[model samples]
Target: MTSPSTHHTTITSDPTVPLVRIVREFDAPAEKVFRAHTDPELVTRWLGPRGLEMRVEHYDCRTGGSYRYVQAENGEEYWFHGSFHEVRPSERIVQTFTFEGYPDAVALETLLLEDLGDGRTRLTTTSLVDSFEGRDAFVVSGMEVGVNEGYERLDELLAG
Candidate 1:
């Protein structure tokens, strides 16, 4: 049986710039962690908060590939789409991320995975928006809750 994760997620944002950074450690290998992000089947298992159901429209996790998905809750669906700019398996992924709710604001997201040895991996993500206001809107939108809860669910998946 796997043990519960003891690591805490750290999130930081700069007031002067449109950036949000999140760091979390998982009790799994870097390749496994990266696969969880890239695999559409695994993605729906832990990509968002618990209350919403996710449907993948198209997910191709490779350089120059694009993806779109929707999260539905209470008959309301939220759309998100992005293009993969760079993909380095088990190391990094850079993509463009956009939410249909705020069609005008798009963010560039970079995700990195660091092998921690001892069968652990550290996942770091940075999101840069076009403006500080847009970044603030993301924070104000209860992003932390979704992030933390999602990772917690990821922990469960990893444990399993």
Candidate 2:
């Protein structure tokens, strides 16, 4: 069995659910990267996974505010919503996430922005799911494509 620590994103058993992590870096400042996530207009531009378009239905990014968006893929819309738990400008954010298709499955995601001098930033997202099944579902949901592409779009956005 491969040790959990060896995985880039670990899948922990119940006892270790707290340590699962996912990290992604961006070639922009922490403030810009944080804005891409919290600004509805910017999110609508690049938040969807590959081949999909994201439509922001409602968004109020302040702490305790709620957000909703629909991702259209193959002519089908997948809805997602979450409420903000914490929001600290350019530093960190915590939110609760739930997908309409799997309403009961919820996850808490924390995003940490670390400034890497010279206009670069490191964004690490740690999502804690309610159960192992929830984590598996999230991993299998093709989120990687969307995430990577979104960052690419952000790069373009920053440059232009």
Candidate 3:
């Protein structure tokens, strides 16, 4: 039998500040979970909702490196790019994320991995945008569905 989803994703935002925080747990080790995030091939498999197809333009997971990718659905392509500011393998990643649709608005994102023992891991992510309005837009953009479903796919990847 498949195990229940131990994963959880939460989004918190306020009217006064532009930030979103997500916390999720995985039934795998921190190393495995972190690798899935940094590895371009693994990321393409689980970075979005199930129906979207992903194509990586370039991905470099080391410090000072950058990445760009596109997700296509029904012939519509969504572009995203980011620069890695800091990369500590299996522990933390700090990067700037931008969706090409909103060219001028970029968010600095930090992802931290914690080992929960027994081969479990917890991931905490914080995204800081330029304005509360931008942050609210993200929260209303059906982000939960993408985040939750993407993690579910990641779960399958880990299991395999």
TM-score list, all predictions: 0.96, 0.85, 0.95
Which tens-of-lDDT digit does each residue in 20-72 have in candidate 2?
Answer: 46676666899998998889988787675457888888999889899988988
**CA shift at 13, candidate 3, in angstroms?**
1.7
Better of 2 and 3 by lDDT: 3
RMSD in angstroms, candidate 2?
Answer: 6.4
Candidate 1: clashing pairs of residues: none
lDDT of 1 by residue, 1-160 (tens): 4454588999999777899999999999999999999999999999988799999999999999999999999999999999999999999999999999998899999999999999999999999999988898898898988898889889998877
Q: What is the lDDT, from 0 to 100, of the residue 37 in candidate 3?
A: 92
- How far off is residue 50 in model 1, in Å? 0.7
Candidate 1: list runs displaced more than 4 Å.
1-5
Q: Is candidate 1 or candidate 2 better by lDDT?
A: 1
What ranges in model 2 sit over 4 Å off?
A: 1-15, 18-20
- Compared with the true structure, all predictions reach lDDT values of 0.93, 0.76, 0.91
TM-score-based ranking, best first? Answer: 1, 3, 2
lDDT of 3 by residue, 25-110 (tens): 88899999999999999999999888999999999999999999999999899999999999999999999999999988899999
Tell me the TM-score of model 1. Answer: 0.96
Q: List per-candidate RMSD values in Å.
A: 1.8, 6.4, 1.6
RMSD of 1: 1.8
